[model samples]
Target: MMQPILTVAEVNGYIEEVFPEVQGQYLCEHIAPMEARVRAVVGPQNLRPGGTVSGPTMFGLADCGFYMVLLAMIGKQALAVTTNASIDFMRKPEPCDMIAEARILKLGRVLAVGDVLMYSEGSDKPVARASMTYSIPPAR
Candidate 1:
């Protein structure tokens, strides 16, 4: 397995620099080899009418988690963007913090494929799953 090029702190700093709006919402927890873990700080704004975490909130966590994994492997290339994504909402998430565990299944020079599983904090079962593909920018 390939080692990560960036540390958790570096990835978090890069995200804060480029996406200040989401600075405290998403946090990179850990990164190693082809995997990354991220946490989403869920607040009232992330809840739906039923007091359950909204689908969009889970989706955002998955996307951010996968991005962290990619950045950890490839360094801070801000231009890398999601090309495709599919998500399944497996269960209703509690109105609390959420964690996303992302893994890279395939990585190439120009594209990477990965998946993320999201769970409410302290839960063993995933509430959602997302598969994503990202387009990597050409080397300068």
Candidate 2:
């Protein structure tokens, strides 16, 4: 298999250059990977009253992860649009940190599909899973 020519630095650089605002509350790791992983230190800002990470927060995390992975492959394309999303909350997340591992299931000229499995830090079981599809804008 061919090694990915881009590194995390390059991918992150593109992200910073294109969608500076896409940077989320968590830090994204493993850019340019066949898959992407993001980690967040959970706090009141991301949690509900019962100490569970809020659904919206998890959704945001997975969304950002998907965007980042697609960008890593397609490069600095901020106009990519979300076409669909399906998320499942499988288990409760840790009250402290949440991690999402995302991979692209398909990458076509005009469309990209990906999924994310999120886990609470220190836990082996997934807390949630998100499947997303993105529409890449046709070349200008």
Best by TM-score: 1
Q: Write the per-residue lDDT of candidate 1 for residues 64-127, one digit (tens) a residue.
A: 9999999999998999999999999999899999999999999999999999999999999999
Candidate 2, pairs of clashing residues = none
Backbone clashes per model, in order? 0, 0
Total clashes, candidate 2?
0
List, residue by residue over 7-118, the lDDT tens digit for candidate 2. Answer: 6676667666766775546566786455778776577888898888999889987887787777777776779989999999998786878888988888889998989999
Model 1 RMSD in angstroms: 0.5
Off by over 4 Å in 2: 1-6, 13-24
Q: In angstroms, give how far residue 2 of model 2 lies from its true place.
A: 6.9
Which residue pairs of candidate 1 clash? none
Query: What's the TM-score of every candidate structure?
Result: 0.99, 0.86
